[model samples]
Target: MSLQYVQGASLFTHINEVPKQYAYLTQNISTDVIIIGGGVTGSILGYYFSRQNIDCVLLEKSRIAFGSTSITTTLLQYELDSSLRDLEQYTPLENSLKAYKLGLKALDEIDAFINEQGNNCDYEKKDTLLYTSKKEEIAEVEEEYNLRKTHGFSAEFLTASSNPFSFDLKAGLYAMDGGAQLDPYKYTHQLLDVSSQKGLQVFENTEVVKVNYLDHGVEVETTYGYKVKGKIIIVATGYNTQLFTKRNFGVKTTTFNIATKPVTSFGGWPGRVLIRDNSSTYHYFRTTADNRILAGGEDISFVPGIFNEDAALEKYELLEARIKTMFPLIKDIEAEYKYCGAFASTQDNLGFLGKDPKNDKLWYCLGYGANGILFAILGGMMLSKLYLGTFDENLKLFKLDRFDG
Candidate 1:
């Protein structure tokens, strides 16, 4: 059985056409660093290291960004649904602030890269609206808002009538600045292209069979029967890491995304405001530059054998129904495309980033939950700085040691 999310859409179906770059390790090879899982994190890390003249090689089990990164809705916002006040309970105030700042900085860096490279990825600065249908649920926004203000994050409160939505909500928290959106697949492949030009080698269709941490370097065994060694190894495999480490550090959750036909009346927002309902499984949404509505949420309990075509079809129907209520104009709208994938999430809703305690040179960047794109950019930057031997204060808060359980 194969994962739908990893299977990928046809090259011609996506917004951009990225040439397939595939390589296999048929012979013994060595590099300064070996990156596992060529998602956004590995690709960007390789790009940054290549720029620093480091000999880096990235290995992916399949195509680049063919994992959760491709299925992501790709809303680039620093507005964390995890309450800042809640984060302070588990971590230091300074650490929480650093996490917040780092997410924003990553967004800024990615935007700069897209501009500098002159890549057209439909990246746009938009406001995210946090709204709900229930009047009682409005206070959650206030509670979340107080923390944003306390942390000096720019946010505003909006009543339903204050915004352009045809329907009314109790209240919404709007992050005015530092929030942006993009086509994640295009953005990720663009990084892959740039990385290749910079001497960063990416090997697709090269599934990693095992990892051996040595005193001097890490050795990775591939399905093709060869040992590729590197000074360090970074794992961006997301949920697939469970195959190696059976520890309960990662919880798999399911989220659904449905691309509705373009909603043209869309004056209520510049499409930046993302609404977070105060439900156990919160739903959020944002619009693409072309006016298509991307709404995703309502987490389904994870079960084995739940990602098959049958399951995906059922979830697609659920999302289609939910999107209709959110946007009545598209009553006849059907899902153009649907994706179901697991995002490793921690109890605190923050990512797990650092070298594993068991192996000093084996690092991981996982558990962004619904905010992978934002943290992927941030994780890439931090990993790059760590590779460059720079002390990044922001990376400390999300250290894997936080879960001593």
Candidate 2:
């Protein structure tokens, strides 16, 4: 069954074997930390917290990795949704640099985890290119490349003459060791499966219906009438955080994705490096291990359309056309899977983490943007430390109220 937030079959979930489902919470329990979502972020938190020997319970209202996690494009990048020059208007250049560096660190963390846990998620690191085919967009792309170079980050600027791929390019930042991709669905289960062996209690199909704040801690109850008490509760429920607070963290929109059936040859997309266009509304392209071409973008306002099948089909068709336009040489260009789902973005293109500014007992691990999986990796490391009283100064970049006036 498709989730309310997702409108089509997820390429990752449909191809992978069914993951083991954990039993629902049927009895009252107390733990040091109660994680309120069981997607990638929550599962990652469970891995870190349990490895640290902290008592924690992870609750998922539905099956694990079956929400927005299923439909995610998962073209992991170190760059923000906004470029450095654009993000400076919202925060300092220095802070954005910190976030970017933290992103690399998060990538390293994922690399280490994959090394330690085995790479069953089709995880691979590839060079990334953020380019534009429009002549006017060259300056913005160069500015981003220069920013990275000035900060000692490795990147090569490519114009139409220096372009390496078959696709048209006005200019682009070709970054080596700059990006990666994974099957987020498999990664979530990989983490949860291992974390459960380390004393982390995981419950699926268990909805957290209500939460109560105590003087020294927080407690929550399930829809089936079971209580869970903890010193603190971390909200990893993604965009569905209205139950904890009414604050709008960022603007949510519907993004669509289309994955073609496995092709014999990938023309132009040499090395199968991940590629993203440098436009306000741009498409991203990546190749799967099984040799399928995936394209995602075509964003629209979240309201009304995320619920409309006709709108989703239109986006899917547009995305399919994009794939054919970009690589007409590929034979049998047929879309095997297409999906759309809701995602949010901030002005600075960062996710919220650490303590909730308004509540001491409640914390947030919401990773909302293009760098979501990367941000979630950062949260799993930083927030887990914050839970043990060691604060990472870099978390200031992800402050929940940083956008508030």
Candidate 3:
């Protein structure tokens, strides 16, 4: 079954022009590695593999970064969807700490990649605020704060009085340089552009329909009747993984977002920090380089064929109302763009990264969380090392069989 990706106008696509397109696969090709998706994750994989002197071929059914990547809010945070205190219940504390630390490293990796390419994708470093609206949840927020402090992270606990924003913050944790934001659509193209110059072959409008596992390698058949032979195959498809496995790896949801026109003042939003509440289904807001406010997070359980015009309008209205309620000072704020798309979250809220246990030559790097971009960075680095015969202990936490009890 197919899934609906994006349903409305995305602000990122409106601001950025489509990058150069690649030809579809029309003949049999061979490579060391074949990436199945050409969104941000696949582009990242192509970048990492090509840099390591691997012959990499990336295939996309549609234009690059035109799917869920275009609709992404591009909030890069080290924090996962599940809090550190909560995640420790599923795995060891050390593993949870490693996941958190990996996030920081991923942020640095992205920064380095952007600098190395000299591509301006509106990348910027910013602090993050995880706050709670209800006074009763103050203790839980403090517990999360203490966990971070114990791990040697630079975090501060703030109350309603110390909070910089005008909104009600019963308690909050301010993480220093713990998050960042960028233009995902542009970043994907920039990375592919750099990798293409280094012998990476990217094919757009090329959909892999079937895979035949050979004794020495694998052959992937495209819908266009072409074949791609690779020693290893990497599935970087975001929420679409039914083609690779029958296991239910995670749950899918529809997330809504709204972007406002550029405002002249920051008002009480100090330093324009990335803000997310402590609610179960939290709302997150951040500022764009062009001074527009982007607020997202009215997530609901996924239902087939649920992304229609009526659904988009309803979600957009709710998102617009949320922005007005949180920051009433921004008078005459009009939503210039509104969009919604599918996102996935794992059982433990950690990404699935590593080779399929049943198929060693087949690797999966499905990053299912709010910090998906960060996870993608880690997946690219670790997977590259894995192919070079270097195994990381942390991969145990993200292995495909981790959920098989």
Worst 10 residues of 3 by lDDT: 1-10
Clashing pairs in 2: none
Residue 262, candidate 2: C-alpha displacement in angstroms = 0.6
* Residue range 165-205, candidate 2, lDDT tens digits: 88888998999999888888899999998999999999999
Give the winner by lDDT: 2 or 3.
2
RMSD of 2: 1.5
lDDT of 1 by residue, 1-405 (tens): 125433224221264565566677678899988878777767777777787778888888877766766777776667565666666666666665666777788777877897788766677776666666778867777877777778788888777667566545778777776577777667767787887888888888888988887889889899988888999888777777754576666577777666766655654334435555656677767777766777777666666654566666676687777666666654455556566666556656677777787877888877466566667666676777787788677666677887786
Give the alpha carbon lDDT tens digit for every residue of 215-237 in model 3. 99999999979999999999988
Q: Where is model 2 more than 4 Å wrong at Cα?
A: 304-306
The local distance difference test score of model 3 is 0.87
What does candidate 1 score on TM? Answer: 0.89
Best by lDDT: 2
Q: Using lDDT as the measure, name the better of candidate 1 and candidate 2.
A: 2
Report lDDT per candidate.
0.70, 0.88, 0.87
Model 1 global lDDT (CA atoms, 0 to 1) = 0.70
